[model samples]
Target chain A: MEELTSIHNQHVKDWKKLSTKKFRKQTGYYLLDGWHLVNEAVHAGVAIHQLIGTADQLDEHRELFDDAKAVYAVTPEIMKHITDTVTPQGIAAVVDLPDAHRVPTQPLTGAWLFLDRVQDPGNVGTMVRTADAAGFTGVVVGHRSADLFGPKVVRSMQGSQFHLQLFEGDLTKWIADFKENGAPVYGTQLNPQAKNFRDVHPGKTFALIMGNEGQGMSQELLTATSDNLYIPMRGEAESLNVAISAGILMFQLNQ
Target chain B: MEELTSIHNQHVKDWKKLSTKKFRKQTGYYLLDGWHLVNEAVHAGVAIHQLIGTADQLDEHRELFDDAKAVYAVTPEIMKHITDTVTPQGIAAVVDLPDAHRVPTQPLTGAWLFLDRVQDPGNVGTMVRTADAAGFTGVVVGHRSADLFGPKVVRSMQGSQFHLQLFEGDLTKWIADFKENGAPVYGTQLNPQAKNFRDVHPGKTFALIMGNEGQGMSQELLTATSDNLYIPMRGEAESLNVAISAGILMFQLNQ
Candidate 1:
């Protein structure tokens, strides 16, 4: 039980760097800021590289020490210095980035969600959680979408990241793979000419593509989808929030 | 054409106060940030108390001046001082708060969404936008929900606030009113005993209630509804984001 009271500690400095995507890429690990996420990672068998917390938090959650390879007790000020949140939750974990390329050997199955440059971390995270609730098997976060392990996205995902397979890759290739395998890939747009989502009935294996906050699905991916779908808006609202639209489509298609 | 050069100007000082809920209530006005929201407010025929902008913004949107009762040109620094966003869009507005109690004399006809103690500003705004997209005619925001006009909520709303009637009131009373009028009021929760939302077929006039983010619904409201409804979860995620749940429920109920 090593006690590190200085925010200048090398380990603390390294954990603080996890806040940036480039740093997380340089080192295959990300920081989980609160007890809820840390607990979820441990329960899901994620490899905990290290666990750092205040003396009181470490004592209260002493059982979690068994799962971590290293544990350090620091003052609240040091804990705050290591996490990005305005008020640190007093405990954090450094977990190895799960392998995104680990798609099962079996044929692609179940509902899959593809993000096409969805930029907002909150929107990206909410859609992932909704995909999990809707029974989607995995999410292929397209290039230009918010980094999956960014602090904001991780906080919003609320531990659903561990429940579903998440990958970052080219959306065009993912759509092609789904279509070639005979699974329907539905692209969403506001165009009236597109088929209404309710009219398109999908089977157990399908993919839904959500686009960017403003520009929407790239022209390439739009052309790549099997058929484009649109949710019927009966009111004067110009469009639904990207995350909202994704939830509606996921629930409807998964049925 | 009055040009104000100082952040200390009385008008600038007054506009800055609008960022707080107390001042908004005291003055019956709130600030609309950016060109998008200001333009929407003008087009929607909302009463614009005053329009404040930097020199370039005033010139570019000169046509909007006719709709605003008073327009003031200010230095970029003053514009920044008046707005809450990190980068002031060079334009902002003071809009008289629309009367929330102005429910139509006619019976409530279209679907109405009710938010109970949903505290996240982003969640509140997204749900409002979704309600509009789903053709929900109005939203009754109950006590403890985020202030509808808060900066984060207003930003996330993206002008959908102008598309729907938003009310702030007691959830119990709103639920009772709908029930008394013979329209089924559905409450949402995660308990297994609650009826599945898919099984409940709502007509054009029913009301749906969404509760707090952490706590699903107040016990009182859960007991008061015609029936409590739950969206069936097929995966291991504990629950849906409040806004996502609201979106799924609103779209499903409207359909």
Candidate 2:
């Protein structure tokens, strides 16, 4: 309906701000890149406030703009500046952060995953995606971690965010609530004192806490966990990749 | 130690060629970037043909070159040219590929993991690392997949290749050998007809085949598998990251 050609345009500047975590958090909105992710967000009823793309991308993904969303077309140079990617997928959406900031589900019947300062965006997204596949009840993003609404995190989740409950809370408080709710909360540590993951026969309602890539779970949360589980490494690698370990633990414990 | 300041020096030219897959394959050598990986290769008794680093990195890790065939100091400018990374870690090595081409251990008494055209270098490396953590016997790198010794993959593997038996072979032949040796082989696909991974109570000796990022396992290998396994998804995500699924399968199948 409208065209923006200059990189200095006010709207373009505002969209570019979404690239930063502070701006996204402040505005309660973030951008989704590529057609597949935006399509999933649309199908999941995410509150998409605006769609911007080149005419060709619009023609191909035309169905995505069907509802109450402002639409804009941008010249190729403006598109390049807005997205900041060399090969822009040529489409993006300005959407509200999903309603993931909840207290752990009140009943706490399904499994929950808590990430403690998991800094890498891809790792954060992969952990969330796997938690969904393992049928975990929800994911609680710990404070000081990669922003869940960041573009890289969104891409790595591959739209799994739309399918599951996501929460951000002080993990200390979440662990306390889960313990009070009768869901045995577990944290991972690499030590002889920790029980092997294979030994865990957790109930349907439980919580698993995965922590920072280099630093394991926070000391305060580890102390609160009912049991600290270790995934044994027979190899010389000091540790497993954080997301891979999360997947193994979630599926094994959920079963 | 000798010093190499010119990026166009004859030896520097040859070393830089290791950055490409075809050149590395042709020369039977590849580059390892960063101190952690180069250190691991040194300790693992991997054939490191040459070591290159700044004076400080070399002095700190001098023990690494005690028995090295050759060692050299390079200018920061030249170091930048060779690795092409913004932060080069001030270290790298030209190392021979490990002897990962052996036939599947003929008796095939332990678990085997196969990668069938999994293209993402990080995914391929993570798969190998987790397989080692799960105590699998060996990993077979199938054709058309990421080069296991490529810089990105070598970094992601975190030196797990040294801890496990790695073989590059046609997966079809490996699957046949696995079956012929009385080990049940499993292939992953996302279909209702396939058995859910949780339903599998597999024995200690087995072979698990993971497929390409987009395409599942090739039909040739799929038909050879004793069972096609599916990691059931409880949420809306279409499938798990290849490395994450491999981690789940390896640990669950091992148990």
Candidate 3:
């Protein structure tokens, strides 16, 4: 076991850098701030590069240390500085970022959720968790979407990331691949010509694409989809929150 | 227009206090932090006690002044101090809080959503917005739920607060009132005996109750409803986000 006390320590400084996307991308690692996520990572067989915690926390969860490639006991002040939390949880982990670009070796089946530039970390994470609950196959985070490995999304996903496949790819290619595999690709829009979502009975093998916060699906993707679908709004609200729309569609279609 | 350049101005100090729930309760007033919300409040016919903004912002939206009882032009520094945004929107309003305790004066004829101790301000507000989009008649923020007028919730609502009625009340009383009016009240729970939400066919005049994020609905409320309903989770995820569940149930039941 290694020990670190000062926030200025080289190892502490490196851990603090994981908060930024650039650092995580460069290092192929990201920080998990609390015990629940660290435990989930251990159960999921995620490659945890380092386990860092206060001496008491490390002793309490000593079993978790065996799963880490390295372990460090740090002062509470150092933990707070590294985790960037006002009230530090006293336990953290440096986990390997799964290969987001890895090609799918298995056949594509079951429902899939695709993000088309959905920018909010909370929305991105909520949709992923909803997809998992809807029993969807996976989520494909398309171009300009929030990074799944970012801290905010990681917090919002609530461990669902371990339950399903998450991919990063050009949505254009993913749409083509779904169609090539005979899966109907559905795009959401508010245009008059778009079919009501209730009318579309999607099967197990299909894809649902949600768009950005202020904008609907891109024109190109909308035109490429098998059919654009809309959720009928009976009230005066101009639109549904994207995450809410995604949840309604996934549960309704999956059923 | 009266102008104040100093962040320490008496009016600025008073406006800043609106951010605290205790101060808001004491004065029966709350703050709206941006132009869009101020515009929505104006259109909704909500009572605007005062409007505060930077000089340029006040000039640009002079028409909004007619609706406000008082208006003040302040420096950007004072505006930031009042609104508390990292980059202030240059505008804000002191709005009268609606009487959350007022009893209904008209017949209840459409679907109503109830929040039972749902604590997350964002979740509470998102559910309100979703209820609005789903054509719900109103939402009852049950005891212990997030304050509807809180800043985080106000922001999440995105003007949907103007689209539907919002109330704060005891869940048991609301459920009883719904029943007395010959409307079925549905409670959400995960118990095995709880009917699948898909199995219930709800009419226009009914109520759907969601529960706390951690604990489900209070046992008393669960037992008092006409029948408790559960969304069937097809995936391994333990549960759906409360807001997502509310969205799914609202749309499904309304249809």
Top-scoring candidate (lDDT): 3
Identify the runs in model 2 with alpha carbons over 4 angstroms from their true place.
A99-107, B99-105
State the lDDT at B110 in candidate 1: 85
Question: Best-fitting candidate, measured by DockQ?
Answer: 3
- How well is each residue in A148-239 modelled by candidate 2, as lDDT tens digits? 97878888888888888888878898888889988799999988679998898978888999999998888988899999999887656688
Of the candidates numbered 2 and 3, which has the greater DockQ value? Answer: 3
The local lDDT score (0 to 100) that residue B67 gets in candidate 2 is 52
lDDT of each: 0.88, 0.85, 0.89
CAPRI grade of model 1:
high
**Model 3 interface CAPRI class:** high
Each prediction's TM-score against the native?
0.97, 0.94, 0.95
Q: Residue-wise lDDT of candidate 1 within B10-38, one digit each (tens)?
A: 99898888878888888889889998899
- The TM-score, computed over Cα atoms with residue i paired to residue i, of candidate 3 is 0.95
What is the TM-score of each candidate's chain B when compared with the real chain B? Answer: 0.96, 0.94, 0.95
Clashing pairs in 3: none
lDDT of each residue in A7-90, candidate 3, tens digit only? 888999999888888998899998898987898888888988999999999999878877889999999999988877788789
Report lDDT (Cα) of residue A205, candidate 1: 94
